[model samples]
Target: MTSAVHYKTAWEDPATRQAWRRTAMFRCAALLGWLLGFPTWLFAVVMTPTWLLVLWLPVLWVGIWYTLLAMVAVTTLRGIRRVLRVYPWQVDIAEVRAKKKGSTQFVVPVPERPEKSVSLGYGGLLGTGQHFWVRAMKSGEVTSAWFAGDPRYVGVVATPGPRNLLWVAQREATDSRMSPRKRGVSPEARALARAAGARVGEG
Candidate 1:
């Protein structure tokens, strides 16, 4: 039998939580600024023919679209970097268990009503209905367990292995229990899993 290694999920520790809060606050502020500024800038561009001919509305729209896309891309990259910086530990998974239906509640900022909204709220707005519970073991003993709804993250758990037992189980669970609409994982996620050395089933 292969030895099991322990893994710690993101935002599990106090330091991680603090780091996440800082980064999240910054991100929210950036998002709010963009939300407020983008429309105003677009309106100015549309109304002011001196900036660009009003006849070139299509070009202006395309430019705006690409600019928004770039902003999103930059923000995503920064978030990824921040996450990596905050949680520097390499997670090693021992086993994974899949749930046909699972739910978890987490907190998120309500941009429109930040002052009125509570910081900690309920519901799985950011998560998928499906869940995978993963256990990481160290020295033949379990250390930590994490819940994930995204197949890609689940793939990360299944990556380090003497054998990919979790992948087999995941495939079986997905096929037998999931509805047709939610039967398969996304191609992108599957590809990512494969790249990370995790075995993934066909979508």
Candidate 2:
């Protein structure tokens, strides 16, 4: 008897939006470093005199390698910390339809974009669909959740918490039981969600 609820994506929240913006910028910088580090080092090597190469080439190579490695390590660690630091966004609970084995399925529309949705898959030992929230991230990425409450007002923790692999496995098991259905919000939807979030700051 639970009807669908219309709610915005977490990105719609102002604080969450700003935090994700910082995260995105950090990631972009990391990616740029990964792409340009080797080429920049190679260029420096090529520009050096042959005599200098004989004396410092190995040192330069080792230094560059370690520098690049450190950049990658720091970027990855910071990204993880950023994600963990951002609090989970509250979801507007939409339709809580029952699936196989008493599991439940729901879709939270990515704010201002009707075309995209964040689908949640819930699974637990109770078979009452009262625990474990799971959602797909980018390809090869995993996300999971823990939830509380019931149909009227349910609370969800969407952060990629500890025990990620375990939650992912539980999600996979729950998904396997689901009928053929699409998962995750689309890229376009995500972009729109970001745009909408940005507008909130502008206003």
Candidate 3:
């Protein structure tokens, strides 16, 4: 698992309204850019003839405007993707330490949070590195597992010592059969939970 996972700020809190607001802002910005383009271009064209030395200024301005517009569109789309019901996920871990005979203590780590994603593709939009598809409950058992959409391979990170943490991604089609009990909530419910305690119809 890669440590540089790019989680959006909007996803950190379970506020549907806020998420919606952010999405709406993106749309509004997109609209504003579209509406402003024609006028700006027309104005630039009109001004160019008045100043022969600046005849090429409009071309440069349009290039810069389009470039900025594209960037805004990309950022908006990325923000939208981050909050997608099918793409977002949250993973939590719980660790336990027990004392045994001969003054020996054993530590065990258990998953406490939910696992989710935007799509069923292998690796995240960014690389998820190598991961595993744990088949059974046997300790130290490991195997390779492909993401739902993509066929690329990623390494599954697991707990190192006792009471370690490991949260892996799931395949879309096989999530029902592969995920843990509580983690197997319905897609809608999972989306809510993954959003850090968001609930549907709670507007």
Candidate 4:
């Protein structure tokens, strides 16, 4: 079910960009990478069997972090380049697929192909990380999609905030490893599955 109230986002402007830069750099890009990458590396090394089996695990582990850092650099540079160029803000209606403490996920209007638009999988927040860890909550803000035009700023969240909310937010990709069968397209099916799983666990 979709929320009846729609949120309007702030327009991309100087203040909005400032807010975005601080959040992106300190919270997500540089700091977050180092914090997560180091711990992950340590965990892998400490784990007894997993690393031993994957013999070259140490080399691979360092390489993984290097790759992540490189990606962070490239993405930052690209976004900077995009910001330099002017693009029309394409504000379109998006379905509030998932809502979490700090982030919101939604499907943007595929103007060219309406059929390709996301109308499923948002039945509930099961896979959306609603209760999971997210930094956006600390600031009482969310990043929907940055540099992609203020899509109503954030189609999913209609909360009152900066008019340029989109300037600071980017739609972080979601985990889609689960099979379609497990995703459960409709809400009722998902509910039933959860109930069954609960009953099984009780046994």
By how many angstroms RMSD does model 3 differ from the true structure? 16.9
TM-score of each: 0.30, 0.28, 0.29, 0.33
How are the candidates ranked when ordered by TM-score, highest leading?
Answer: 4, 1, 3, 2
Give the poorly placed runs of model 4, Cα more than 4 Å off.
Answer: 1-12, 27-70, 73-77, 80-85, 88-92, 98-105, 110-203
Better of 1 and 2 by lDDT: 2
lDDT of 4: 0.36
Sort by lDDT, top down from the best: 2, 4, 1, 3
Query: Backbone collision count in every prediction?
Result: 0, 2, 17, 7
The regions of model 2 sitting more than 4 angstroms off are 1-7, 44-203
State each model's C-alpha RMSD to the native: 18.4, 15.3, 16.9, 15.0
63-94 per-residue lDDT for model 1 (tens digits): 55545643553454343333332222233322
TM-score of 3: 0.29
Q: How close is candidate 2 to the true structure, as a TM-score?
A: 0.28
lDDT of each: 0.35, 0.37, 0.32, 0.36
Model 2 weakest lDDT span, ten residues long: 161-170
Worst lDDT 10-window in candidate 3: 146-155
Residue-wise C-alpha lDDT for candidate 3, range 1-203, written one tens digit per residue: 32212333323434433534554675567556766776776676777766653765666565565556445444434324333333222222212122222121112122222242221122222111221212111233422121111111111222221111122222332244443323334555444334421222221
lDDT of 4 by residue, 1-203 (tens): 32112222222344434544554554355445655666666676687565474664656666565556545444543343243232323333544334443344555643334455542112122222332213343344543422232221112222222232322222221123422232212444333323222111111
